[model samples]
Target chain A: MSPSIMTKGAIDCDIHPSVPNIEALLPYFNDHWRDTISQRGVHDLQTIAYPKNAPLTARPDWRPKLGMPAADANTISTQALDTFQTSIAICNCLYGVQLLMSEDLAAAFASAVNDWMIAELLNKDPRLRASIVIPTQNSEMAVAEIERVASDPRFVSILMLVMDEKPLGRRSYWPIYAAAQRHNMPICVHAGSAYKHPVTSVGWPSYYAEDYASQAPAFHNMVSSFICEGVFSEYPDLKVVLAESGFSWLPAHLWRLTKFWRGLRAEIPWVDRTPTEIARDHIRLTLQPVDAPPTSEQLERLMDHMGSDEMIIFSTDYPHWQFDGVDVIPDGISKELATKIMVENPKNTYPRLQ
Target chain B: MNIQLMDRVATDQKIKLAIADCDIHPAPKSVPVEIYPYLSKRWQDYMETYGIIYRQGFPTGPAFPKGQPNAARRDAYPPGGGKPGSDLDFMRSQHLDANNVQLGILNPLSCGQGVQNQDFSAVYCNAVNHWQIAEWTSKESRLKASLMVPYEDPSASVKEIDLWGGDSNFAQILLLSRTAEPLGQRKYWPIFEAACRANLPVAVHAFGYGGAPVTGGGWPSFYIEEMVGHAENTQSLLTSMVFEGVFERFPTLKLILVEAGFAWLPALSWRLDKLWNRMRAEIPHVTRPPSELIRQHVWLTTQPMEEPEPREHLLDTIEWIGWEKLLFATDYPHWDFDEPSRALPIRVGKEQKEAFFLKNALELYNLN
Candidate 1:
């Protein structure tokens, strides 16, 4: 996987530009929040979603000696942009704002993360775009934040974690969805947790490996929720991007959902088309951390099972190690499929990316 | 059990293997009465007065009610008007004899797994254990029982396994895939320990009403979400067991996933191995790679099979998962039943087909 087959102008759908520390976000915070955070003597709110030194958290060679990896726009340009020759990269700053218990604090921290993303990363590079990190604790606040920052063309999507306080498709969150659709932004459910609930329904898993492995299934349930909750019917044009969610489990998942929908469509009559059709039209997934079979033939067949090349967009999940070397694209994907994934699908997914 | 009642004939492929259906549900005609003959009088009276509560909301029904009545194929209901799988004669005609099933393992989903009353749960499980033999397995030679135990109470679970574990008629120890905690936790190990002593494999069927939300985030809207959630729940448990060293602790124990889809097997194995390779110190008990552990220990039944648009893609996954690890299952009488003859890929060679249809179940259950 170390060799470069990647062509230029590929749009990396998900890349995390880590906030260096608590100090970096302090200026973006309001006078009340800035002094309140300092008065309380708080430290970096970075959740253990990614351990600082874990190999999965950061590729060893990409790690800086001084601070958090990919904390700066310069490192991202050289390490991700120049290497993959990507024209545009979306900075989904996964700092721990959503981890706050108090809705006010969550809103404050989320606002700070968004502002910092604009000032520190998105503005610094013409190639960098970002998702507006919303305070998911309260829908009104989340929507307010969306309205505030969404006007900036640099922000392409609304960022929410996959594992959150409630299923993201519930009625309570409709306001946020309404705001996102009104602004022509997709809801990007990135792979992270709010820590409010166990990563698994059974309870918290013992190892990070178990937590990480649980993400694909989490995506399965999330997609089902969105489709069955009539999120698509309510807002027909809205698209949801499952960032850092693996792809292999999808064909079977869609099959299962659509199969049941045939017998059980009456339960949710709004789902007029097959669930697979709904997903293909509205949902998209990132390419890196590919949880594919060992052979290229198998990978190709698996992608074929996706029923459309348009559902997957190009992503390196940069600075974090998904695969070693430049062989970012899985070996067996056909040149035509690769071109569709790299250029066309992404530009179509994010209107701003075009 | 009458041979003359058999409606359908076996295909040559089925006849050669003497195919086994790994998942067969055996419910009671009436909840307490059918089981009453087996239970002690005190528990019977207790059931009559209070009844069982699953502890999740809605005492009368499942948390997420099924779209179909009894969650069964409409054709599965008996002509005499009882729940599906309740009458042996109807089952023999419709499923067993019709499919030419050489051996069928009864899953009996209503076997007191999610019962709130632990004391009553223990006794109810014990009663169902006897009732299965009396009602179906004892009468039907082609059928076997999945020994029911109160998994919520492992000590009691061990007691149930102690009584029926050695019986060949009872093929495997039944535990739901969704438990109160991850199935791999040490609290549940004693059940596995008892299972090993009896030389019975633990089959984690895809049903558990352990009062937990079906999904990690929160409750989902529809039954469709719950239906797709089986794979997710099972995959999490598989990861939990591997990382928590359930396999290493009980090296000989085997696991079977019933009604849980197996398409994600190859990817999960790879992901688990990749993650565990870098984080071995956290769980030193798992000496081998997670994928290797999965290969040695885990097996899945092909039912509600992954029907990708181009069907051979299913075969491509099975090729990676290895044909030997799969056991053919119909999830008999369920609405989502898979007909064995049509379910498997046509491209698979005869030898691999034999392994999937018959050999895997035989070797896993140690039945002839």
Candidate 2:
């Protein structure tokens, strides 16, 4: 079911652009990457290589026809605004763009992508906002790209694929954070469609579903790394949004991480506040692909640990298989709290919205 | 034959239908003042130890929310709640009546604490086992017991098993799921071998009786989160037993996994078979499919069967895992214990219902 039309603006923090065809947009990217895509070796992107301005096909799913003739500003605007009724859509580059470029070339490709998204997609619809993609594999280039796009109001935050090279807290990536802080934008860390990292200490996960179930462990490590390395301390005003990550795992991670911190405070004396305290202040988490959606009782128990509603921000990793629909938000939570998750908390983080 | 006489006489074929709970815990009435009663006099004199005690009913530590002395600690400590740390009257009143089962096995919470104390594990385990026999197990006809042992010290563990074996009421040797080493290793053979000779089955229960660090981290504040992933520990336990040739060496030995729900068995079975075939060269002794050995010797309980998928699906899972291998359990008084009648709903058709609820447990636990 569709959400009720909001009397006030309803900001959508996440929206995935479905790419069912990609043959058209290949050449729109710079010609310097002729050998790069071939060397990267992701066959799926290569097989459906679309040429620039070729006639777009309406794939059965409403994914973008990348190599086909572009839908002009008006057609794209109507679908993103009138059809979806989203006041602001946080758009990003094509998910597979990085796979085609080396770490250095990826930064160039990222700048090219931001240029395309800002000029074509964001410029078309007043409601659409963009998250500037960075070449996460190379921090220096990523910082440069962030600074270049920092002045653009259409660009809201730095979009990070969770499995990107180096977690958010690594010293090499500090410059990228400095760039985001300089521009007053948050970093939006979203899950990627990769599971090559060791999800848990136990062993490699046995099934595809188990791998999906392990997003918490990944998010937990990122949160721990951020807190332990004093990332939040360094960037007191900068916010971090764990997008497309589930909410239930947050309370457990906060409790355990903070409790361990109490026993071993010497390990990280710089982290003055408890992990939860740091999280409530500088961090926000979204709730799509909620691994263990609680019953009313479970929700109350979880809220007890979370202590405040502001800790979570609402998101639907849209058009992906595990998206949350309108009715799934239970009436058990107070309307004010629900509104905070759905709108207010996100506004606090992504301030460039209409 | 009278019930007591028939209990002794009934063979595997008869299946005279006694519902036996393979796992149940009886917490200590009080942590004993004297930890090392049997230590050499010289050693005892040298060691006047600081053992944890139950002030109200929970273990006393330095303090609570603050590092308050005992006076302030009393205020913060949870009111000596349900069953007073495995009080028998509480177990019988809350569990026995609710489950309507014939027998309840008493596992000890402090047994793990004793095991962790290293030097004190042996004497402490002996004292707790004797206390269970005299106070809890002997008091009720329907109440049986499992002997806890000093798991780190294998010979001491075996001795504890032998001490309890003479008593028919002691049905199983209780092992904690979290141990220093895998049970299948050669180091644990003394304990398993002793269990075989004593004619007592081995039951491994989860270690989270009171703040035993769970697998991945420190203790979970909520019990539900700690309990959900318990089956993985049990799977580890079963793999250790099967591949270690515990079952192959002692053909009649039975291994029971307590409190870990039976739902994981089907998926685990498939995965084990895959691993056993792939790593067959490493474990030269385990020639057969791991599933076959598991079916032959291992059994599991269904306690706190949280939110079962449709009854048909529940039965479908059982069918896939061989229904006869499961035993009904009510992990009663521990906050989230399932009511047997409520948990084992009569939704499944009559034939499979009796097997899961009563018959299979009786056959496996030798409580005919």
Please give, for residues A6-29, the per-residue lDDT of candidate 1 as tens digits.
667999999999999999888888
Candidate 2 accuracy as lDDT: 0.59
lDDT tens digits, residues B224-261, model 1? 78887888889889999999999999999999998888
Runs in model 2 lying further than 4 Å from the true structure: A1-7, A19-22, A35-84, A97-101, A193-196, A291-294, A297-301, A323-325, B1-368
Every candidate's lDDT: 0.84, 0.59
Chain A TM-scores, all candidates? 0.98, 0.82
- The residue-level lDDT of candidate 2 at A13 comes to 73
The two-chain DockQ for each candidate, comma-separated, is 0.68, 0.04
Candidate number of the best DockQ: 1
Docking class of 1: medium
- lDDT string for model 2 (B70-145, tens) is 2111222224442333456656655575456687777776453333455566766676777777777678888877
Top candidate by TM-score: 1
